[model samples]
Target: MMAERLRHDGVLVVGAGLAGLSAALAAAPAKVLLLTEAPLNHGCSSAWAQGGVAAALSADDAPELHAEDTVAAGAGLVDPEAARLLAAEGPAAVRRLAALGAPFDQRADGGFAQSLEAAHSKARVARVKGDQAGRAIMEAVTVAALAAPHIQVKTGAKLVGLLQDATGRIRGVLARIDGQPVEIAAKAVILAAGGIGGLYAVTTTPAELKGEGLGLAAMAGAVIADPEFVQFHPTAIDIGRDPAPLATEALRGEGAKLLDGAGRPFMANYHPAAELAPRDVVARAIHAERAVRGGAFLDAREAVGAHFPEEFPAVFAACMGGGIDPRVQPIPVAPACHYHMGGIATDMDGRTSLPGLYAAGECASTGVHGANRLASNSLLEAAVFGERAGRAARDERPASGPYAVVTAPELPDEALQTLRQAMSREAGVVRDAEGLGRLMLLIGDLEARHGRAASLAAARLVAACALNRRESRGGHFRADFPEAAAPDRTFVTLDRIDPAGLRYAAE
Candidate 1:
């Protein structure tokens, strides 16, 4: 189908989550056309975030300490420069959101009430009422975005592909609205389309996300960094729900302990930080415990007890729905695909290899998170980098002209499901060369069969990258090669993938 032309003067931002909203707000005085696939409040993973935003807001806390903790949590692959930037600028971002009217929880002394989450060396996360940070922050940003004269929001619009010039500089985007494809010609494009969790069979992200932004950028030959790293939250409430409900890590931060069915604490045997260990360590420990016995759970009984209702209302409600009282019993738990630490490689300013294109949030890998992200850092990354990208985009003038809108290929439903199941089975929390190799072959076959839906292309990139890295570093664990190898980042572009080098036979 020929794309419909829609002209906009300022920037075109895909995804209306925190990053997209932040970008739109930062690019003030410049017109922005913000596209969202679902209703403003409903389909964003940002609203599901429970641990709150990590920032050095207390006088006793410092950005340097936060940076060190982030690097440590990332397991040696973190970019010190990016970590420093994220930490240094974190307070301002939090304050910016606060100034925009986000009701952050304050201490009795009127200071920010900061809590310590997994892997943090200090109690520095600025939370809202228990676990309401994400929802509250989004509500504030959404209201700000709606009232902004320069920002125009197009809800229920799905970004299908990017429009690029003959030399491949992105000029705009091809999006679908009410089943009709439309072309948006803009001066600059910012991709803030969240993470790849939706690509897995079981994930904490919205189902429609599915890495479309990552694939679109990659197909345009954008460099992808550390595509192999996918984080699995160690404690998602396993209540037989699609995209299982998340049990906030803040519970652990508040002293909830992980125990087996036998009522024995197991985290201490794995990491010194125990329940407060980095997510990867804790997730792996849970997976191992489950493999050995039945499954693991979080015993918040003694830690929070009756405080659960007042503190973590979301988790408390979910437990009540499952006929379990979190105040008394342990909540059944297991690891679920939660975050992606890697994405379209970008600098601190969020510029991609392709000119005229910028990305932020979970969609862009700015190398700050490295191998594993610290708890609540995803929100910080979105705010800090989203502002940077938005400002830089607004300052630049697009080189004159319209570009051809690239049509995205469609995929069969069966083929897409096969890919999701395969990824969840093989490239999930625990992995091995044999499974990863098989996964690559399956991805190749699916690509050939489905003719490359952006989601499938993204799945291929993640699976292929996971297969190539032969070490068990951070989230990309290799059971066969269960040790770190040299410790460096992995970068990939479409040109680098050689079909002949694949270990498994193509279907």
Candidate 2:
């Protein structure tokens, strides 16, 4: 079996979303193997991103203002330098994507068209065809990946574990392609796989992002940061979809309003900015409203009106698919787990605490999105950090030999559904000590029975972290401790994580 393995002298990247694509392109002239569980576009949340990348491309805006907004939205835990780096480098990254043929929306003056989203001080989101930015940018990057000479793409390849060397440094990946196991040895392993949104019963992410990337890194003993801060998008269209369709934040950025079942506007009651409040505020408001008013909804008729078909075609199509018309009727909405602000912690260079292992995209917590990510910043983070990780990985030296392969764990279908339900019920928007303790007990049982599936590990990390943080801030809202406390960012490695603590003593 050792002789059967294929080896590459450069980076082996797991996941083919924007981050992986950017990494592959950045590691130019080096041998790169890009692996994906689904065809390039099918499994990635990047393509489903309707909001554009946030950058200070407009003349009136500056990186300082963007950084300020980012820090403000992150609720006191944002690293100033990381936020500054994101705002300063974000414009160049957007320009690079455009150079690669991303179709950004342009104004009559031939400049990039920008829009405003929640928590931002200005209109800095660079969009494409209104709601098609993600799809368009991803399409352009995918084309570049396909044309790049150094990248070798392997679709339908599911990564099970990282291949580590005798010295505990990651050397490569152990993946299953077409139901057959394959080992690919490389100089470095980069996990750009994505977030753990799919761990919840209801999410607005791709169904496949079930905590594999974060779990694999954690299983390999990497530090996990802020795992409790799960950002729930306030407007996932409630259309009975498995992975709910998003009614993009850009709608509200453009002036859409949130309403209750009686068609009464409600956001104004929660925040002074109403529809323009930070995401966590809006999500919690919606959750609270739905608890009493039957349900919540987004009324875009007054804001978008007849322009819905032209300005937000993707959203229009989604509304049409669900037997709702955005032009006249209020679209049904719910709070769904949308983004993970917490992931395998990494630095500006995208290097994790472990040697030879790197992370980027939604899977890497660079301390930029401290506790809650600002609208449209996710794509920017992926681009800037993915390229950095790729460039850094390209310069690494290969391991002397491969590490021993271990069997990856899997939960029975019954256990998987139970885990999802438990996460959403306990670890979702509103959390309490009692619920978190119960969740920890359940997670312990699942770990004992399932042998640490990536999904289980990710769920436990979030639940344990949520239990430990007694105060509510940003995406993490503890019903038991609702008031904001002193600002503090959490950092934890696998050894320090004790779900049994309930208090997150290890944190």
Candidate 3:
């Protein structure tokens, strides 16, 4: 079918999460067209984030300390320069949101209230009334984006393909709107689509985020970095929900305990810091406990029992809806895919390897998240690098040439479910050569049957990369290898991947 073509002499932004909204807002007087697959405050992970934004906000903390924690959590592959930049700009990013009417909780001295999470040396996470940070922050940003004079938003517009010129420069996007194809042209395009959590059967993110943006960029020959590293949040409330509700790590920082089904604390046996250990350590410990014991649970009865309603209302409500009052009973927990540390490789300004295209938020890897992400830094990266992407993208001169849309076949629902289950089984918290090889075979079979859908492409990248790395480091753990190798990052373009079978390729 022929696509209906439209042209707008400005910048086009994809996805309506924090990153896309921030980019559109920062574009200022320049006209901005923002497109999303769902309504504002829906489908994006930003609104579901419970732990709040990480920043060096308190008197005792500095950006250097925050950077140190970020690097430590990333497990040796973090770029020091990018980590420093993210930490240094994090404070101002949090304050900027507050200025835009985000209702962040404050202290008696009118300072922003903070909380400590796993791996942070200081109480640096600036939050709302506990778990309400993502929702509250998104509400404020939504209002601002809607009110911005230069920004026009089109909700329910699903991105399907990228429009590129002959020289390999991105010119615009091909979107499906109301079941019809529409090609929208612009000077520059910023992709802020969320992560690949939907690829796993059990994840803490919305089901719509299947890494389409990452896949589209890769198919267009953009560099993908560390696609193997997938972060599993240690404590997703396992209430038989499709997308599990996350019990924020801040609960642990607030003194929650990880206990086996036998009612015994087990984190002490896993690491010295016990409940305060880094997220990767805690997640693996929980995974091991769930295998030995019937299940693992987060016990907050002694920590925030009566204060649950006031402090973590979101979690409290979710637990109640799931027929468990968090105040009295322990919340059933599991390691669920929470974040993707790898994505379309970009610089601090969100500039991708491909010209005329930029990326931000979870879809863009600025190297701050390395092998694993530090807690609460996702939102900060969205605001800081997103603003830079907007400012940089706005300067692109208009191009007047014929552009072609790169399209991929859509996978059916059943096939998607099959892929998701395999991902959680083979590529979940702990990985091995056998499981990874099986996953690659499964991906190849699915693609052969359904063609190279974006979801499959993204899944293939993760499986192939995980299969090749052969060492346990951070989120991409290999039980067979069982140890860390010399620190190095994986970078690949889609063209380098073998089309017929399971294989890893490089630049």
Question: Each candidate's lDDT (Cα)?
Answer: 0.88, 0.90, 0.93
Pairs of residues clashing in candidate 3 = none
Query: Model 3: number of clashes?
Result: 0
| Candidate 1, 1-507: lDDT as tens digits | 776787788898998889999999989888899999899977778888888999998888899999999998888899999999999999999999999899999999988998889888789988888888999999999999999999999997988889899888998999999898888888899999989987888787788778889998998889999988999999999888778888999899889999997999999999988999888899899999988988898999999999998899989998899888999999999898899999999999999999989999999999999999999999999999999999988976866665765555866767767877888899999898788778878877776766777887787778778878888889888888898888899888866776632632332
TM-scores of all candidate predictions against the true structure: 0.97, 0.98, 0.99
Clashing pairs in 2: none
lDDT of 3 by residue, 194-283 (tens): 999999999999999999999999999999999999999999998999899989998999999999998999999999999999889999
> lDDT by residue for model 2 over 309-415, one digit each (tens)?
98999999999999999999999999999999999999998999889899999999999998889999999999999999999999998767548763358778889
Ranking by lDDT: 3, 2, 1
Question: Deviation in angstroms for 225 in model 3?
Answer: 0.6
Q: What is the Cα-based lDDT of residue 339 in candidate 1?
A: 92
The ten-residue window of minimal lDDT in model 1 covers: 498-507
- Where is model 2 poorest over a 10-residue stretch in terms of lDDT? 498-507
